[model samples]
Target: MAKIEPGNGLTSAVSRNILRGTTESLALTDGEGNSFGSDSELNAYTSERQTDKYGFIGGAQQYSEQSAENIPPEVLRQREAKWLDMLNNWDKWMAKRHKKMKLRCQKGIPPSLRGRAWLYLSGGKVKREQHKGKFEELDSQAGDPKWVDVIERDLHRQFPFHEMFVAREGHGQQDLYRVLKAYTLHRPEEGYCQAQAPIAAVLLMHMPAEDAFWGLVQICEKYLPGYYSAGLEAIQLDGEILFALLKRVSPLAHRHLKKHNMDPILYMTEWFMCAFSRTLPWASVLRVWDMFFCEGVKIIFRVGLVLLKCMLGSQDKLKTCQGQYETMELLKTIDTRYMQEGFLVREILELPVSERDIEKEHLASVRRWKETRGELHCKALPRMHGAKAIMAAEPPSRQDLRQNPTIIVELPLATKSNGEDKERKKTKEEKNGKKNSSPTPVVADLEPSKPPPPLKDTALLGSNQSLSSTEHDTYL
Candidate 1:
């Protein structure tokens, strides 16, 4: 007989029986009739005593597995097989089947394959390989204190309900910190932005630390340059572009919004800033990201138009809102029934918008914004080219950042009095001689002596606070 050491105060026979999968009931005490504690107490103590050795400190369930379980097994298998083939011959597949790749992305990438797929789709793998050991270097160094506190403050607020981020020092949150901090270090000028937190958190859920970091870089530099910078010039410009597109796509909603003195930044900031992560349902957010990485920032505009149409399209629905604040409240707290992942995705896919349409509107919006602000030169903040050297050294396919010429425009100051504001705006439009023919341009009554300060708080649009997560979930 082998000598057995005491384990959790269990006797050799009891331990053996339990290990052998026998469920015989045993007394709580020794033969002396003393109490060893009740079964429930023992179980509670054992459960409480358990610690995660690997430091993940969360549920064992994989996000990919949970997301994939809804699909039919055969469908999942086929998708997995296709994904495997793409992975095996990535270069060839990307060259010949690029359109096919986009089509498949529109259908939604399989959750099981999403991790690797995002890596390939974002070209994160190539960037990661080229800049090997760069993340470790950045991670080892301390991040600037300017961004560290801000990053820490927002860490727990992101995905608090999710298992991966529930624990304060869990692997997920830690990786998120490293990635965001690394970016701050990577581009000291841009520092950090609150919107980047949820974006990085989402990425961390899908891939490892380094890959997630590079993916974030791709998004910030290529897909959304100047967005996370101190001045937020890109998002400001894009907001104007979104408003322009909205006017064309849904004239009623646009007119109603304009009539009430609502600005695009009022409701659209969160929509564009976080790439719809904080606003949309989790499942829908994932699908949107799948297409977004492959298609770039154009997906964001399409989805925003669809959302606005869904929320404020009908005259009856628009009638319910009394004022700008009420209209904004209605827009922010859209009902989930209308935002079902599959239904919403189908609507987004069916929309007749294209990148060229967005680009054309973007240029026009930039021109209008600059003209309204009475500046001929671009006054927006410059792009951070810190990673340009590394990106330039990589092959064309591996180059993560696309150097689109920055189209800069000034953000107009919010008007104060409704009556005076509308009169001034109308006068400006009439002076421009395109009031009725074109979408009402967002223009300021007075251009400030100096540019406004960099936006530090969540209130990117103006003094009004951005919608909280709870506010976002509430139905109007």
Candidate 2:
């Protein structure tokens, strides 16, 4: 991606780093499935040899993965064993992952486990030495230096079409902004990324700012590699991984996804991004989060694969729609009772998943996610416009808290005011004198202007209103 100059005039080095943040992270997972090392190794590798994924012209390391020998049997075996043990006894495995232990998550966790579970799952259970109390206080105030820019850009963009996030200026938007800014200040390194909004939004719902920041740090570090990148290749790579898994589990869906260039990662990105807030209900999100924190990143893939198969098997014929339509539909259906059933999780586990199932589930989920989002947003154009018009027409509340005080002012005392001023003051006092004496703000629901009285020549037996009193409360 080309660099867009930041409106904020950051120093050359700071701006460069911010621009390169995604590139730096992507240095770990380039295109063509070649990983230089874990994210831990990305800093050293990128610093020594600058540049990024798909930019390979003559780099030896970038091209080596294609020619590299198949992963050794022992390494694959250890990976399988490690993964199997985790699936069977998640609590035991996760206990070792964290310095301070957390219990296993519920049998099936949702996608909104971005905070508490994210931290626990990413080995961030222990207290961090940095930004303890400061992180907590960041929520109540305004204007944090680090996050103000990043947070402002994505106010409701992540799931802009979700009605829950549609209000132009409301509680959800405010809280999201506060939590994100706080986290950015708290972790100047991770700073803020475009993908952080969903995760931060989920955390703001469950936790105060400080804890949420720590939890976010943990998830980005341990559970997700794509979260903090410039171009977000981790999403593509992980989606490919899910695509591979789905093929093993469901061939029919695999063919569909392949036809449309769909992948399970598209459906599950929100799950990885915010622990599933975009996909699952709050209860399910937390439930899944509980397990996510207890298990590891693999659980995200496993549960997602499982959910895909379950959602597919449901109703024999999977629901049909366009790309966005299917994703939007899936988002709506994510909270249905069918998903909450315990047996579904067991069913996914029982499937041999032999590569083919994973591929199919991955594909079907891709289509479904696109459909789900379409319904959540684009389908609601009339309602979205209507809702926005209503919100705009309504009187705005006086909630400005960031205004600076101490402006120059030199108003004369009452005795010095002109007659017009005195008259105006008296009229204002008379208008408000009979109301409640309290100084606090008052909000009144107003009715729209009524039509002028009918012409005298055509008068009826009694005066009539074009609209009833109930109609006054609403507008067309």
Clashing pairs in 1: none
Global local distance difference test of model 1? 0.64
Candidate 1 RMSD to the correct structure? 28.0
Q: Tell me the lDDT of model 1 at 73.
A: 71
Per-residue alpha-carbon lDDT of candidate 1 for residues 48-164, written as tens digits (9 for 90 to 100): 534332112222211332222266878866776676567656666666777787788888887766866776677676777668788889989998987897787666656544545
Q: What TM-score would every model get versus the actual structure? A: 0.67, 0.44
Question: Which segments of candidate 1 are over 4 A away from where they belong?
Answer: 1-69, 374-476
